[model samples]
Target: MQRRSFASAVSAAAAAPFLMGAAPSGGDTPASAAADKRLKRDMVASLEAELQDRDTARAVAAWIYDIGFDWTPATAPIGAFDFLIAYAFGNRPPANGGDPTKVLAEPGPMNELLADTVAQVRAKRTLPVYAQWEIAHFLTEKYNMSQVIAINPVIAADGTITYLSTDGVAAQIAEKRKSTPGGVGTAGVVGWRDHIKRCVLTTEGRGMKAFAPEGFTMPDTYDPESGQPWTRRRDLYLVHDMNAQWQMKRTELVARMYPNG
Candidate 1:
């Protein structure tokens, strides 16, 4: 499948958004760069392409049966930017290793996304949602959803906390499935449209078939403080799109190298 390249869609350099003149981050203040009509058209077109695959539809159907048969959980991996922003901006880490409980104390875009995921679960027969790091903490603590496969963060010998990346989370889910009797090998991945394709690919790399439904995209609202939209910050959106492309390609290469996994 020849997916549209975000690079081709947006003429701006992938790093353009972070430069000095870059548009303000967050809130309703529109970035001059993001206002490029051509970029918006191409981006929307490319993002829409992410859902044209038949696998997504199949995944939705599979979820119905798997939920009834064995309660296969859908994975809700957090986006990297969400954590980086909070961490970079004086969100103090808990003593010693980073504590998921103490991280992301206040609600943000990720919380809104998880809320949508939780709603999907409730609407779709109450299956578990597999989550990691701050996302899992919110799932179990804020929403009080017990049907969750929460992947804990890895604490290093130096007490440094390293949360699992998307691939790492997929590996954990795969490993968990291996030990459980009759664990369903198929999973649904809940994520933004731009990032969901990569999420599905990483899950597949871990030896399980995965699918991501369409329309669960980033919120369009602006932050009152920064006036930048969650994913609309021209730089942030381009960076994510480019990164998703790279990660998807890397996942394909890795899968080829380790076919047996």
Candidate 2:
């Protein structure tokens, strides 16, 4: 959220991101930060407060899907969001105009496009995680520091979806920690953690093509199924193992770290 290239090198000013989460830093690194300790503490506390309200949780869900749902015109949270999710995934032009750039620029036309986008997301994909990543790909780069969300979905073995939030202490450790000397972005956190838990380790290493465009070739064992990128590690985890232990770790970590702090 602080425009620190947590996902991709998404420009903060313009914010055209590839994705919001990291692609596994090849090792287990802590989720520490360089910001003032007091500020981080306050921000975490504020997020906790926000989650207590029903309205806030709804808004957060919409935001997690915003990239595909498109930023503005978030009134129709479910249906509207679903449409944009489709439009974004389709990578098709809006009905208002042939060019998405032009239509997106003008809110009048963009709103119309958004309405249509929601339908597309619904028609094509049932899961909205794809759309969420798309938005994170861009928004996470330049969004204001206060505008961050943790929409990581952890599916339990029993077919339960537990969306991980930034409100958790362990999840916070997955941020772009900068305290380590000579290892600013090299050491990975969230993406890597998901990969380890979700995807089966190959003879080579973590597979991450789904998270990248076709051109950015990774490793040999990184081959993902069609439309299945490493970004969807949560889903992979579900397919491989159906457990909520990871989510439990985050929950426990929160109590230990903020014990009446």
Give the candidate number with the greatest lDDT. Answer: 1
Model 2: residue 83 alpha-carbon error in angstroms: 44
Per-residue lDDT of model 2, residues 1-261, tens digit only: 543343223222212221222232333243422222333334434644876643333333332332222211101123222111111111223346543323321212222232233233334433222222323333334332122232334556765544333223222322322333433221111122222222211101221111111111112122222122322334553333223334433454467547785
lDDT of 1 by residue, 1-261 (tens): 234344233323322332223343333256534553334344434544766643333332232222222211233433210110101001123435445543432334544565556455445445556666456566666677766666666876766656556677777777777875565455656654444555666677788767643323433332343212334454565465455555565565468546898
* Best candidate according to TM-score: 1
Q: C-alpha displacement of 246 in model 1, angstroms?
A: 2.5
Q: After superposition, how far is residue 94 of candidate 1 from its true place, in Å?
A: 7.5
Model 2 local distance difference test score: 0.28
- Report the poorest 10 consecutive residues by lDDT, candidate 1: 81-90
C-alpha displacement of 74 in model 1, angstroms?
14
Among all windows of ten consecutive residues in candidate 2, which has the lowest summed lDDT? 82-91
